[model samples]
Target: MSGRPPGAKSVDQLLEEARSRITRVTPEDAVSRMADGAVLVDIRPQSQREADGEVPGALVVERNHLEWRFDPESDARLPQATGYDVDVVVLCQEGYTSSLAADALRSLGLTRAGDVVGGHRAWVAAGLPTTGGPAT
Candidate 1:
């Protein structure tokens, strides 16, 4: 018998609640968008990326510097030479981190920002072509 409210959620449940705020898109959809000129931004750490071959044509932007680089307000930023309205998709190894990264990008006014739901692992699993380094 517990004294907590009937609907009270545990700590794990609360954290998961926050995680669900991020939107996710399927790997196939991401690929289609990429073919249509959407920039696929890989935010996996360099070591992981090097260990596992990267997606062909995906922009390699380390997670730590992603927000500053993508956020238009940040003076220490890379020029959005392709224009700010470009569709940008972020990816990580397992999809979790990329969701947060995409949400952050959306917060920074990148309305077209999104993340790969199944991530690079799913991309590889889906038989997509990759380049850079040897396959994991």
Candidate 2:
């Protein structure tokens, strides 16, 4: 028997559910949204940023603190956490984690939360601007 409870969902199921709740964007689409004032939030850890570089102007809010930083009602929120209506696009090394993170933002009432289709890798592959680390 699998160790999980009878009704417990698998990680894949959870991911799918999370993804269904928010729209995912392509790297190019992400750029367009950014140009239109959407915030591109990079949720990768420092170690990964050091190894893979980072999007030139993406906000660096690691996954752990994401909820607090983006929750407009939280005292710990960033100044930009103006309200639930702000457009927030989260990114990770790959697309997987960002989907989940974006869903979490949606739960916090950030109606415009979403993620990049292929994450930072796709961004780099698409020739979007990045900084630090070795060139891909």
Best by TM-score: 2
Worst 10 residues of 2 by lDDT: 127-136
Q: Name every residue pair that clashes in candidate 1.
A: none
Over 1-136, each residue of candidate 1 has an lDDT whose tens digit, in order, gives: 7587988887667535435654567888888998998888999998888888888888888999898887776776776524457688889998877877787777677878888977898988888888776735
Q: Which stretches of candidate 2 lie over 4 Å from their true place?
A: none
Which residue pairs clash in candidate 2? none
Q: For candidate 2, give the lDDT.
A: 0.94
What stretches of model 1 exceed 4 Å from their correct place?
1-23, 81-84, 132-136
The true-versus-predicted C-alpha distance at residue 95 of model 1, in Å, is 0.4
What are the lDDT scores of the predictions, listed in order?
A: 0.79, 0.94
Instruction: List TM-score per model, in order.
Output: 0.78, 0.96
Query: Model 1: how far is 99 from its true place, Å?
Result: 0.5
- Candidate 2, residue 35: the lDDT equals 95
Instruction: Please provide, for model 2 over 53-126, each residue's C-alpha lDDT reduced to its tens digit, 9 standing for 90 to 100.
Output: 99987999999999999999999999879999999999999999999999999999998999999899999999
